[model samples]
Target: MNCQPWLKTLVYKCINIEHSCLLCSELAEQHYPLCVACEHELPWLDEHCLRCALPLPMAGLICAQCSRRPPAFDQVIAPWHYGFPLDTLISRFKHNGQWPLGRLMAEMLGLQLHHRYLDDLARPDLLLPVPLARRRLRERGFNQAGMLGRWLSKALAIECDEQLLLRTRETPAQQSLNAQARQRNLRRAFALASAASLKGSHVAVVDDVLTTGATAQAVAQLLREAGARRVDVYCLARTAKPGQA
Candidate 1:
């Protein structure tokens, strides 16, 4: 039997152990690129909305926004709150092209999903990265969400189709807008490259963060309309509601 994969993993572990933790200068005690302490200190999401992953007072309840108008996506799986060094890492990876940082987060997210799948989270048939507008793609040099999807595809053995979704037009950044304005900004901003590929398929839309979730809703609606059986959102982090701590 081939031992290359095992050998590579062993070698990687040897090297990883010798490095320092990304968050702290401590030895990387964990098998990953972080020490146990640093990893534990990250802003892990605990109780959150069952539907949108929004931070809530308790677990297993849908947020008011989702209750008022249910999203097209069936569920959202995010592992962290958008805060602290986690947010800094994401911003650096997204804006400054710090790919290794992004990969580290994606690896962690993939591990979380793997455990969730063993429980009740339904494994999706297809991983679709929310496509970026052509102009933004050119300016950013790479699509961070696409990278996350591809990495997740490898880790979870899922089929990732980067070309399945297409951003037909550019919209203003969603960060500055509230949920309603964000929905308006994304109107007609996305399209599916091929509806046939999504027919009766369970799809997970991979993204970096779930803020207002306007983009996720828009894409999920389109996919559902095009015959997708179910669509879910997978992202690194979720932000709190407007007024909540």
Candidate 2:
């Protein structure tokens, strides 16, 4: 009997329901398991490229890479820079199977998206989680993006389609790859579901983090070619450029 699957299920089902900060173990003042002071200390995104959400020095400015060659996605929405506790939280949720942490982040991200909608940020017609390769999914026992999309769907009342995209082929991990290599590795890696119909529809790709934006770009390009009017990437954090972090 393989206990790994059962353990995974247990991890997903069990959550820290107490209103205590996941970070410092203090009583959470608000609904989230995070206190106001700890939340304020998160590495919030200050300035970034309008297209890829790459951290920048100033607002209302596009990064050099985007200016030279715009990506397929229209824009990226992220709440924080991938640093310190943010990175640690994401790592635990992703690799260590601590799903409650991911859930908390997704909830806050949903709130941020709701506020953005109120400020003229267009609401997407559908939320599409980036599909995990079959092998990786089997190894991890869960897809972080899919979970995030499910939570966001409920919070925002937007439909989430887990079957909208499929990972066509398994590829090497993108963590060690540079931008060009990452893009090359993702080529022909994703395919739209045969029954998907996105003609003129606005869609958002949900993921845990946007590092090189290569995966998001590939997914967005595929959706755009499939008749999606606009494709945006929604993620929890964005990493600094290579060698900058």
By lDDT, who's the top model here? 2
Report residue 185 deviation for candidate 2 (angstroms): 0.2
Mark the regions of model 2 whose C-alpha exceeds 4 Å error after superposition.
1-18
Instruction: Give the clashing pairs for model 2.
Output: none
TM-score between candidate 2 and the true structure: 0.92
lDDT of 1 by residue, 108-135 (tens): 9999999999999999999999988888
Superposing all C-alpha atoms, what RMSD in Å does each candidate have to the true structure?
A: 4.6, 8.8
- 218, model 2: CA deviation in Å? 0.5
Where's the lowest-lDDT run of ten residues in candidate 2?
9-18
The lDDT of each candidate is: 0.91, 0.94
Runs in model 1 deviating more than 4 A are 1-17
For residue 155, model 1's alpha carbon misses the true position, in angstroms, by 0.4
